[model samples]
Target: MNNLGFFKNPTQITYGMGAANQLREIIDAQGFKNVLIITDGGIVKTGLIDQLTRQLDGIHYAIFDETKPNPTVTNCDDAMLALKQINADVVVAMGGGSSIDVAKAVCLLATNGGSIAGYEGIDTCSNDLLPLVAIPTTAGTASEVTTFTVITDEERQYKLTVGGIRLAPKWALVDPLVTKSLPSHITASTGLDALVHALESYTSKMATPISKTLAREAIRKISSHLRQAVYNGDNMVARDNMLMGSLLAGLAFNNTRLGNCHALSHPVSAIYGVPHGVANSVLIPHVMEFNSLAVPELFSDIAEDMGENLESLTLMDRAVAAVDAVKKLSKDIGIPTTFAEFKVDDSQIDRMAKDAMLSGNIAANPRITTYEDVVALYRKSIGGALVEVV
Candidate 1:
């Protein structure tokens, strides 16, 4: 790091107990026309979309509620078509990352006039996307605050990113109340995902002092609140803190990209159809273990942030405890510790490893990563027939 460090979070975040209800006022203030509310069917069934529409007394809006997990370019096309059908000028994404990612791509395609595949790399688009207002119903993903959107490209068998300041949501309405109805498993997985964000950003080679501070606090809050939030979803304090923690993590990683866990998990989820957070949950402990060699003291700090006590242990032992702490958290939250539970096909390892190394995230990892390192990590994460990476 030099005397000058960079920290950027472009989204205007409005967080409170009832922050989601302010959507109508924001839309009206902006004079946005024909709002397109993008979300998954689950959120539609939750009646959240209705709740949103009820607040918009006379706003013309349409709902595209077919966003799938690890949203694809196809989903973006569908959403763009829906936006075109209504000629919507603004978009309101009111679900997890999938819906928000689809909306971001739609915004890009609406203005840029190209397939989402063309804008796969960082800062690849020149034009500004459509006006976007993100309301995150889950504590994880934090797409509401991030400048990156991961869209699965089925043809490539990869999770493609369209990232830049232009992709950031104009506003993030983070209402903990919107998260009160989340099922326990979702609360767990999403919260765990937030933890991984903080962990990776905290130790990222690109981390700045500002990102580290936010990541550290995020780790502390998530470690303390996630278990309670998962087991007792109705607890408002736990929900609120989890949401806040997730927001902080998003803001942190928005500047400093995540490490091997995110890099590795993308291919796992794309290949096996495992949920993003669950795949990350299984890979995080291993990533921590691998990264500990590069920054042992940082790992120790992570352990302390996660509420683990070193109690006069060796320096290396303290670092190892960080990996242990992550594993314990996953087990306690019912996240699978291995890929076997997901029926991951080991024969896919070579292709997956190649794809994993292709991630831009690998450059930000604290450790010097090689294609061979990614192959080994996959073998360790997926303990099966383990065809040698050719």
Candidate 2:
């Protein structure tokens, strides 16, 4: 396979400052009724639901707002119950990846019938789901448009990606205005998440020309705008760029897939309750270092995209520059530089490593990795000390 393989994106995308307000008209045009609005509690507090409701005049609806930051299969069960009770014809998700993932799971299981785990891995669902509309509150994860939906199985203690074209949202309403009021820390973590998406996708074994193009642009936009978006939450220009970056990264990773950074980060999140973006931020530099040998040229391209020198430096040196740039951006935006900062224990490393190796994301890493590699990566991340590259 000298030439990169196939690529596809099936979601209907709408972008701009207030695109979410268009949800009702879009849903109506799709001939969907009895909408089930799924979200986390925080988004309800923002009163954006009121704006959503205003547009949904004739649509019958119900709200399920119990989604947590890391959505679990149990969350899907709860939402499914609500869907059945409400007899919802269309599922609308509002808020972060947790809510969106839950919505995706609910939509699938509602029609497909099984535990969310059965759909784990690729294209397991044989049937079409009810139409789903995704309206994202956070600019991270880009879960709104992607075919991937991660739901935790508490019994198994792993974050599983249940992916298929069937899980892709029928409509993706991206409204950057909703992000303008986000607090600084959230802006930092989620912004870093978007960066990780682009980086991982760019270096993924499955990378295609389309995905690479989108990932490169996503990396540049996120690197240039994430800090500004964090420092100045009200700056629409920064918010817009960050929003676009998050979407492009979502599109990129959705096709090309993610890598070891996400693989290692998942266990930290599953075991420690660390936010996904925060975990990615802490592990990205170390994982990049480990994988650099396999894809040095890719990292060199990444450095240039991140506005660093790529011409004179050797590939390894440029790889180091990429890591350095990520660290600097993380620090500037107040992202915790170490996993230990979250109060996770060294004793937990073995379990975390085992779980990381099982993540589907690990398979897409350019470098073939082992459980020992994941453990060392965890140890390196917990140390919080930056590595110096010669």
Please provide, for model 1 over 230-347, each residue's C-alpha lDDT reduced to its tens digit, 9 standing for 90 to 100: 9999999999999999999999999999999999999988878899889999889878889999999999999889888899898888999889998998999998888887888678
**All predictions: root-mean-square deviation over Cα?**
1.2, 3.4
lDDT of 2 by residue, 1-390 (tens): 456677778998999978988886877677877889999788888788787888888778999999988888888889999999989889999888889999999999889997898888889988998888998877799999899899888887788888888889988999999887677888888889999999999999989888999999999999999888988888899999999999999999988889999988888888788999999988898988888889888998898999986777876899889888888988888889886667876777887777787777789999999877777787788873232221
How accurate locally, in lDDT, is each candidate?
0.90, 0.87
* Model 2 / residue 166 / CA error / Å: 0.6
Looking at model 2, the pairs that clash are none
Candidate 2 off by > 4 Å: 384-390
- Listed in order, each prediction's TM-score against the native is 0.98, 0.95
**Ten residues in a row with the worst lDDT in model 2?**
381-390
